[model samples]
Structure formats: C-alpha cells, structure tokens
Target chain A: MRRLGDRVGMAWAWGSSLCLLLGLGTLLVVLVTRGAPAVGPGLLFGDTAPGDAVLGRAPVFDGIWPALMGTLALVALACLVAVPIGVASGIYLAEIAPRRRRALLDIGVDMLAGVPSVVMGLFGFGLILLMRRTLAPSATTGLWLSALCIALLVLPYLIRTTQTALDALPESLRLVGPGLGFTRWQNLRHVLLPAAGRGILGGVMLAVGRAAEDTAVIMLTGAVWNAGLPAGLGEKFEALSFRIYVLAAEYRDDMQLAQGFACAFALLLLTCGLLASAHLLQRSLERRWKA
Target chain B: MSPTSGRTRGERTAELLLAGAAAVSAAAVLGILVFLAILAAPAWQGAAHVFTWDWRPFHGHYGILPMVVGSLLLALTALLLALPVAIGIAAFAHGLGPRRLARIVLAAVHAMTGIPTIVYAFVSAMLLVPFVREVFVHGSGYSLLSAALVLSVLILPTIVLVVHAHWHSMGKELERTCAALGIPRGRAVLRVLLPLSRRGLLTAAVLGFARALGDTMIALLLSGNAAQVPGSALDGFRTLTAHIALVVATDTQDAAYASIFAAGLILLLVAAAASLTARRLGAGNGRTEAARAAPR
Candidate 1:
C-alpha cells in the first residue's frame, strides 16, 4: 500500500505539472499560429488605412511604429522616475535603515507592489482630473500624470528586486571597501552597485516589460484611439496595449480587429525579446564577473 | 585621520540623501492611499449617491454595490475552482513524482509565472468565452463563470509555486520518523506534511484570492459588462476593477465618476491588508526555519 501510494502521488504530480505546462504552451501556440501569418514588413511598417475589407487584408501600411514609439517614450519616462528612487530606497533599506524602520518600510513596499493596476489607474485619473482643473488641462500634463502613476506602480518591484540583489552580495565586499579607506558612498558606488548591477538591470527590464503591457492605467489617461500620433509629452497618445484592447473590444471591422491582434502579438514579441536579451546579458555579465 | 574624517562627512551626506529618497518613496505610497481617500470622501460621507443599484453615470446614479458584488463573487468563484486544482498539482509535485520528473514539473510551474496576465485575458476572451457560450448555456458566454475560470488559470502559477516551496522546505527527519513507525506514506503525508504546511497553504490561498480579485483585463473582457449581482455562475456580472476601468476610460466629466475612486480605495485597502499578512507569514516561516536549524 505504501508503494502504491507513492506511485499514485508521483503520477499525480507529473500530471499536474504537465497540465500547467500544456495550458501555457497551448496559449503560446495559439497566439503564434494566429499571429505569425500576419507578420511581414508591410504589417510592421504600414498604417491601418480605411477601405480594407477582410481581416488581415486591410492596407495597414505602417507596422506599429507610432505605438512602439509611444511605448518607448512611456517606458523611458517611467524608468527615469522609478529607477533612481527605487535604487536609492533599496540602498537605504539594505545598508543603512534602522531595524524597526526597515521592517515598516519593507511592509510598505510589499503593499505597494500588491496594489491592483486598476487602482493605480483610478489614482491617475483622479490626479489628472485635479491637475487638469487646477494646473494644466493640456495633454502634456496628462502624460506626466500617467507616467507618475506607472512609476509608482513599478517602484515597489524595483526596490524589492534591488534590495534582494544587494542582500545576496557577500558581506566581505563591504568590509574590503571600507577597510581600503573608501567612504560608504564610494563603497556603494564602486563596489556594491557594480557587483549587483546586472541583477538591478534585470529588475529594471522586468519592470519595463510590465510597464509596456499595462492597459488599465493607459486606457484611463493616455488612450487617444484615432488621435494619430502624439505631438508632445502632453498629447494623448495610445499605447500598444490600450490600442489592442480598444481594437479588440470596439472595432467594428474584422480586419481592424486582426490588426489589433497583430499589434498584441507585436507587443508580446517586443517584450519577450527585450526580457530574453536582458536575461542573457545578465547571465553573461555574471559569468564574466565570476571568472 | 583628517582624510578619514572628511570621507566620513561625505558618507554621512550621501546616506542622508539616500534615506531621504527612501522616505519619499514610502510617502508616495501613503500619498496614493491618502489621495484615494480624499477623492472618495464624498461618496464615503454619503454626500454623493453611491448606493443606487442603477449604474447610469449620465443620469447621476453612482451605486457601486453591483460592481463590488461582482468583483467579490468572481474572485471567490475563481478561488473555489482553482484551489483544488492548484493544491492537487502542488501535492503531486511535492510528494508524488519521480525526482527527475518533479524537477521538470517545477520548471514548468516557474515558467508559468513569467507569462503576462493580458495574454491570459486575450486567450480567454477568444477561446473560453465562445466555448462557454456555446456548450454551457446559450447566450451566456460572457458570464461570471467564464471570468472565474480564466482568473483561476491566471493565478494557478502563484498558488502552485508557493505551496510547492513550502512543502519542499519541510525537514526530512519528520518523514523518516513517521516511516520508522510503520506509517504509510499517504497517511504520513496527510497527517504530518499537510498540517505542518498549513500556514503556507493558507498564505497561498490568500495570495491567489488577492490576485484574482485584483485582475482587471480578464473580467473586463469576459464578464459581459453587466452591472448586476450574478444570480448564478452562468450569469453575467460587472466586477469592481472592470467597472473602474470602464468608468474612467469612458466617463468624461461627472461627480458620479468619482465612484471609481471609491471602488479603488476599497481595493487598495484589501490588497494592503493581504500583503501585510503574507509578509508576516513569510517572516514567521523564516524565523521558524532558523529556530529549527539551531542546535535542537
């Protein structure tokens, strides 16, 4: 009976694991099968022009150039806001924070990470409404508000990852730096950060991936639908994710809807590529550092 | 000595600046909570009408009871459906499989964590909605049941991974002692392993529940956009996250629009509480491990 039970349990475990893998694998297969046929230079470089009838047949002459540009703009802006603050806070918590405060701060950061994206959108919408009424009602201010909200959304993740990376470093590095007559700042800048830099970049890349896929926040503030291209930071520009949502949900034309799927596939490919490269880069760097 | 003193002064300044930045980041989180509270103040104070069952923002009714009901029900349903499957998988991975097979299984579970939530949402919208609509009940494709099922898939990775980690971390001595007493492997696992890992299991459940609750896109796309308390799993509903997305995304200017902020405040509070609990549980587990590791 004991032998039988062990056999049963093992079978169950393997079955469950395979189920999970299959489910996710099936999703990827479906996405690729449907999206791959539409991938071409025309799809990449063309604009969705009117008069196209069938799905994937429309004169979407321009690929996702504008949406890609907007995504880049949003991600760059978000990183600028989130990274320095997140890295600095991480440094403080790991290196210098008082014990009691560290616990409180850690809890706060965790909570921040767990806040739902829609709530962030709510916060962004509310903040923008206030800003529009009191400050500037222009699109630039809207972009700033949206960027700030996304930064807040990604900040906790960056801080947590950086802190973990910093914590994983050998204590001897700190000792050696200070013993060599280096100041704490010099020790951190020259020794600790460089050692943990790959991990930090990994975290940043993950955060950027997250920021790129965010639809709820951008939908509320940055969605411009057919507003063409953004004129400036204040102009309401649509992101690929938001555009995918809008196209899938609202578009009456099937070709446009297919174009939406193409956009989603493109976004997914972009993010996966970026993340894969970052992971590879980090691994190579770590290997070099070790050697 | 003078050089060391000068270096110390510079270090102190940098530390102060870093500390200040950390403080500001912490404050930014608090500021979001405060801002939500302030924005939702009118609704909470009953100065604004948020109890109406009607969801016509154009007509000035801002009752969010339906959205709240939909969100909670969908999350609960998802939890109920996913818990059994996730635990079953976790148990299998932890105790049932061959060592080589288990490693492969574990890797698959880890990979699931990296898949984006939107991808899951999109797949469900395209695949599950139509299937549910066709096979289960006619004209009922986008019901709460579909949303729950999709959400279950989305959070399955988190649940399975957490429980697996907890199970793997258990001391081998306990198992050996049980085996020496002629206890069957199944009984030993049921009686010893499950009980020891109860806290971790509960934490996993709570986290999964929170993830399901917090999910927006799946519910937005598949929950049929109906602002009603779902009478059955097959009935359509509008979740809080979905409603917030819809209201904010569509509403131009209205006091009724502030109700989205009210809903957000509720979600924030719930998420914060769950996060704090999970963290404490994790810290407690770490301490327990350390205590056990000490020469006992």
Candidate 2:
C-alpha cells in the first residue's frame, strides 16, 4: 500500500511538471505566431509619423522606434538611479548594518517591492507630477517622474540581489580586508565590490529588464501613445509596453494590433536576452566561486 | 583615525553616504503613504458615491465596491488554480525529478519570472481569450476566467521558485530516514515534505495572490473592462488596477480622480498586508534562504 501511494504521488509530480512545460510552451508559441509576422525593418526604424494623417490619407505605416527609444531611455536612466543606490543599500545590509537595522531595511524593501505598479503610478501622479507642476510648471514633462518611479520599482530587486551576492562571498575575505588595516567602507569598496562585480552586473541586468517592461507606471507618467522621441528630460515620452496596452485596448484593426504584436516581440526579446544573461552570469559566478 | 587622514575621511564619507542611500528605501515607503493619504482625503468625508456599488464616472457616481470585488475575485481564483499546480512543480523539481531535468526546470522557471507582465497580457488577450470564447459558447472570452488563467500562468513561476528554495533548504534528513525505513521517496515527499513546508506554501500563495491583484496589464487588456461585479467566472469585470490605470489617465482634477486615488490606497493596503503576512509567516518558517527568495 505504501509503495502504491508512492507510485501515485510520483505520477502526480511528473504530470504537473509536464503541465509546467506545456504552459510555457503555449505562451511562447502564441507570442511567436502572432508577433513574428509584424517584425520588419519598417517596424524597427520607421517613425511614428502618421503619414496619412499628415498627407490627408489613411496612415501607411506605424513603427515602434519612438516607443522603443522611450523604453531604452527609461531603462538607462532608471539603471543609473537604481543601480548605485541599490548596491549601496545592499552593501550596508551585508556589511555595516546592525542586525535590527537589517531587519527594518528588509521589511521596507519588501513592502516597496510589493506595492502594485498602478499604485506607484498613483504615487507618481500625486506626489512628483503634482509637486513638479506646482513648484516649477516647466518640469511637468513627466520624463523624470516616470524614470524615478521605475527606479523605485526596480530598486528593491537590485538590493536583494546585491545582498545575496555580497553575502555569498567567503567569510575569510571579510577579515582579509580589515587585516590590511582598511576601514569598513574601504574594505568593502576595494575588496567586496570588486569581488561581487559580476553579481552586481546580473542584478543591474534584471533591473534594466524590469524597468523596460513596466507599463502602468509609465502610463500615468505621461508616456504618450505613438508619439515622437522625447526632446528633453522634461518632455513626455512613449514606451513599448504602453504601446502594447494602447494597441490592444483601443485599436481593433489587424494592422494596428499587428503593430502591437511586433512591439511585444521586441520587448520580449530584449527582456529575455537580459534575463538570460543575468542567469548565465549568476551561474558562471557561482561555479567559479565553488571552484 | 586622524581627522586629516584622507583615506579615513573618504571611508567615513562613503559609509555615511551609503547609509543615507539605504534610508531612501524607508523614505520611499513613507512618501507613498503620505502622498496617498493626502490624495485620498476627499473620499473619506462621507461622499454619497462612496457608499454605492455602481461606477458611472460621467455622472460622477463612483462607488468602487464592484472594482473591489472584481479584483478579489480575479486574485483569489488565480491563487486557487495556481497553488496546486505550482506546488506540484516545486515538488517535482526538488523531490522527484532527476538532477538534469530539475536543472532545466529551474532554468525555465527563472526565465519565466523575468518575462514582462505585458507579454502575458498580449499573449492572453490574443490567444487565451479567443480560445475561451470558442470553447465556451455561452460567454465572451475576456471574462474573469480568462483573467484568472492568465494571471495563474504569470504567477506560477513565482510560487515554484519560492517553494523550490524552501524544499532545497529542508535538507537531506528526510530522504536518509526514508532510505533507512524502506519507504519510497515519493511517499516521503507526499507525506513528509508536503506537511513540512506548509508555511512556505502559504507564503507562496499570498505572494502570488498579491501579484495577481496588483497587475494592471492583464486586468486592463483581458478582463473585458466591465466595471461591475462579475456574476460568474464567465462574466467580465474591471479590477482596481485597471480602474486606476484607465480613470486616472482621463479623469483629471475631479472627485473621480480622488476616488481613483482612494482605490489605489486600497490596493496599497492589500499588497502591503499580503507581503507583511508572508514575511511574518517566513519568519515562523525558520528558513532564511527560502524567505529571501520568496519575495519575487
């Protein structure tokens, strides 16, 4: 009877694993089939200029250049903001923070990470957007506000990753730094960070992927739909993810929807590439450390 | 330790600056709370619309009970559907699968976690919606059921990864004892491992539930945007995330905008409570490695 129960449980486990594979397979196939046809040079580099709207005929083509640029710019700025802070906080937690402070920081990061994207958007609109408009109406372009929100969105993840990376270092290295008569901060900077550079890079990659894919926060922060490139930091921008939302929600035509799919494919490719590299880097670093 | 020593001074500055940067995380939480509190103040004054269930923003009646219920229905249903399957995957990877297969499965799950929410949105709206409509002639494809399915898929990777971490941290004592007793590995997993990691399972469920509830893309694109309480899984509904995303964009500087902030406040409260409860449960679980991985 025990053997029979084990057999059934084993079967159930295998069945469920199959289900997992199937779910992933289905998503890939669906995305590929629908999104592949829309990929072309026109969709890649073509401007968002509605040719027909400008020339008094139906628009000939719509491209993802402006949206793609918006996403890349947001990712770049968010990485610039989040990577440093996240690494610092992670180092503090890993090395300098007292135990009680560590727990406090952990809970704070967790809560911030858990806050929904839309809620972050609301926070952005109410606090940054409103404050900017009130303080200096010229700063109400929404670019900086959205970038800051995306930074917040990815900050917790980077911090956690950094913490794990720093913690994974051999304990002997901790003493090695201090043995050289280095202060706590110098010890970390010269010894710890260099040792954890690959790990930190992985974390930055994840943050980049995360910031690029966020739509709700961008939507509230004046990410224009099908607009030209943002002229300045204080100007409105567009993003690939918001374009997906706009095309899906508003445009029912096959052409417009196909454009959305192309954008999805692009976003998916970029996210997958970054995330895969992070995974590879983590694995390679782990193997090297073990060796 | 000399005041004029450049190295010492630089080190001290670095520590102080990083500590200040670390403080930004806590400050962010406080900022969200304070600003949301200030914005949601108007809805607290016993507005007549606050007590109702309908949401006719044009006429300015904004009772968000429907959105509240819609969001709950989607999240809870997704949790219910995903929990069993995700736990099963975790068990397979840690308990039953061969080493090579487990590695592959783990890699796939890691990749899945990184997939953007919007990709899930696009896939579900394009494929799952049509499939559901064709399979069930009685209802539209963009119903609560479709939303739940897509969200379950999106969040399953979170559960599996968390549970896998927990399972790995459980150590080899159980398997060794099974070898001594003549019990099979499968039975030990079903009876021993499953019973042991109950708290981790609960954490996984809460985390995944919060994720589903907070998602805007799926709710916006696949849930049909119907701002009413769904009568059944086959019916359509609008979630608070979707409501805030749509309403906040168009309804600026009005009571409706304030009401949407009120909805965001509620969402913030739910997500905070969920994550807090999971953290509390993780503390009780006594596995720090698993707890760290459980936050997604």
Instruction: For candidate 1, give the DockQ.
Output: 0.38
lDDT of 2 by residue, A53-105 (tens): 33424322366766777788888888889889988888887888999998888
Error of 2 at A225 (Å): 1.2
Q: Write the per-residue lDDT of candidate 1 for residues A11-40, one digit (tens) a residue.
A: 655666677778867877777776665576
Question: Scored by CA lDDT, what does every candidate get?
Answer: 0.73, 0.79
Q: Model 2's DockQ?
A: 0.59
Q: Predicted candidate 2: what Cα RMSD to the true structure?
A: 3.4
Q: What is the lDDT of residue B95 in candidate 2?
A: 56
Query: Which number leads on DockQ?
Result: 2
CAPRI-wise, candidate 1 is acceptable
TM-score of chain B of 1: 0.88
Off by over 4 Å in 1: A1-11, A47-62, A137-141, A272-291, B1-7, B168-191, B284-296
Error of 2 at B250 (Å): 2.3
Chain A TM-score vs. truth, each candidate: 0.85, 0.88
